[model samples]
Target: MTTMLGVLLRVYLVLGFALEVQTFVRLYVLSTPIAALTPSLSDPALDNVPAFRRLYAVYCISLGLLRLAAAVDIKNKGLLAALAIVHVVEAAFSIAEVLVFQHVPPQALLDEPHLKTTGFLALLVAQALLFAYGYMTASTIKSKMHEW
Candidate 1:
């Protein structure tokens, strides 16, 4: 069980890190306009977006740390519960972002929206699964504590 939990944590950390990097490169190095990346939100001043990005970066960093900590503290029900809550929140946010915002017109709208929406939905499902697994892990840990 510990091994499985560790694997899940590492997977999420890797994925989250990749996304953070991709978003940064797309927004800055690639010279892709911010509107292209964040089509859902009304076009905002570059300055405002930067702050949000920075905060998001920080959150991702924390997520990585939390995953590592969860692996170490696998027996801690409280920690697992907290992590599950966070995952659910993230999933909800991703779903809402896709549904509420019109992505900048992709040259190939069907292909892009189809792919993006599918990917986002997949992420949401994955996150929900992880959250459920985490909650179960937490309950197991809690029950084991009573046994001890």
Candidate 2:
């Protein structure tokens, strides 16, 4: 079971890294085209904020690197725990964005593509599952260490 969990975690990490890198490229390198394609995804207030976009790109790339490292060394309990925390924090921020901050207007929500909303919900669930898996993997590793 532990081995299976580790394998799943590794796969998730690699996929996460790929996604982060893709987001970084889209946000930083292809911002204009991407924004044109998905105007609803872009906030008009942030249009003039190039620095914010660049900072976000940097953040995405950093997360990608961390995910890559975690995937390479799945047995590292500390890394697993750190990743778990990251996932939870991200999830919390996302929740706060939509719920607390009202980042997405209620009336405008109906005008957006259903696929986009579904995809965001799917990502949220995946983040939660990843957090659980990371915690389980780290706990398993700690137990095994004591068994030796």
The model with the greatest TM-score is: 2
Query: What RMSD does each model have against the real structure?
Result: 6.0, 4.5
Q: Spell out the clash pairs found in candidate 2.
A: none
Assess every candidate by TM-score: 0.58, 0.73
lDDT (Cα, tens digit) per residue for candidate 1, span 104-148: 343433475457555555666686677567667665544443321
| Span of ten consecutive residues with least summed lDDT in model 2 | 33-42
CA RMSD (A), model 1 = 6.0
lDDT tens digits by residue: candidate 2, 63-148: 89988997887777677777777767766665555544546654554565534653564576687676667766676754543321
**lDDT value for model 1:** 0.59
Model 2 reaches what TM-score against the true structure?
Answer: 0.73
lDDT of each: 0.59, 0.68
